[model samples]
Target: CNAFSEIHGLTPCYTLNGSVLKDASDTISLDLCSCDFNADGYRLPTEAEWEYAARKTISGMQSGLTASGQVDKYGKEDTSIPEEEVSWSASNAHGSHKVGTAGSPFTEDAPPVAGSGNPNGMGLFDMSGNVCEFVWDWSGRYIESEPGERASGPEAGSERVSRGGSWSEYTPFIYAGDRYSYDPNECYNYLGFRFVRTVK
Candidate 1:
């Protein structure tokens, strides 16, 4: 993003590691925020942040923190909004389509498509479905935390955490609250990730 950084007058973001997933290892070394794995790079969103962004329990700009299974939904509860209006789950998706095109047609040579589906209240697209996302937390049972505070997940576990259902699942799995875990080495086409950054 050097050009983006240059035009924007600040480093948009730079990842020190590129596609190192196939050879990743245990999380014991960087289980939580006790250490900095990529000091100047974008990191995966924690589970809580993922859910909060989905449901938007707290408004305005707030520092990142952890939470239990409190608010878990891809978008604010809108019984009025049908799932097909914003999500691309098994109900309307044959397979993963391009980003921004919730249920719209896509072509390889076609220019990028943006805002095909309704964005969440936070103005984020394709968050509820299209692809399940890997998060930055270890897999374990939920730990209770005081209100307004974040709960750092388990110290270590055999599997990593993943959230946000994908096109392969029903609409119910597309939202938050269902925390899934998998072996870091195991990658599935339906399994993908979301990118996030905590502005200091």
Candidate 2:
């Protein structure tokens, strides 16, 4: 994996110390690896957490119209801004531009951060575009359940869940609620990830 420490000073040092399954037939087995949740290590956020962080609200903006009648500096109706203003997608980006350069295209690689795009309610950057983020949940159907502190997915499954759309995708998949899946062992250019740690 490319080192991000130079770009983001907060990047942590991760050690790749796990073993991979060499037997192709064993790929479907869930016993290949085990997670120590109580251990101190970085982990992918759950699907619920990822969505919560990505979804933006009117109150989230630092400075922008909240009511329906207000107009932006551009003199356009500010009832609601398009996703292009906050997400990098095919409509705004011909190809992957820098992580945050709102509408600037052809960069063809994940940018360092969301330059001109607006951050989510949590002040997080690049949650909707740039790249799809791998989450901790395995692929499964949504269930009607009571609200909780952390909503985890099914107990086990073959494909892992990935949230947020990539620069290669259209506006629909780039929304905060969009989700997809992939084999845990597979890797792709448009697929990247973020990590979270327990505050303890």
TM-score of 2: 0.63
- For every model shown, the clashing-pair count is 2, 5
- Estimated TM-score per prediction? 0.67, 0.63
- Residue 101's lDDT within candidate 2 is 57
Give the per-residue lDDT digits (tens) of candidate 1, residues 97-140.
76776635555567337776556656667767777778767888
Instruction: Give me the overall lDDT of model 1.
Output: 0.58
Worst-scoring 10-residue span by lDDT in model 2: 62-71
- Could you tell me which residue pairs clash in candidate 2? 98-111, 99-111, 100-113, 100-114, 100-115
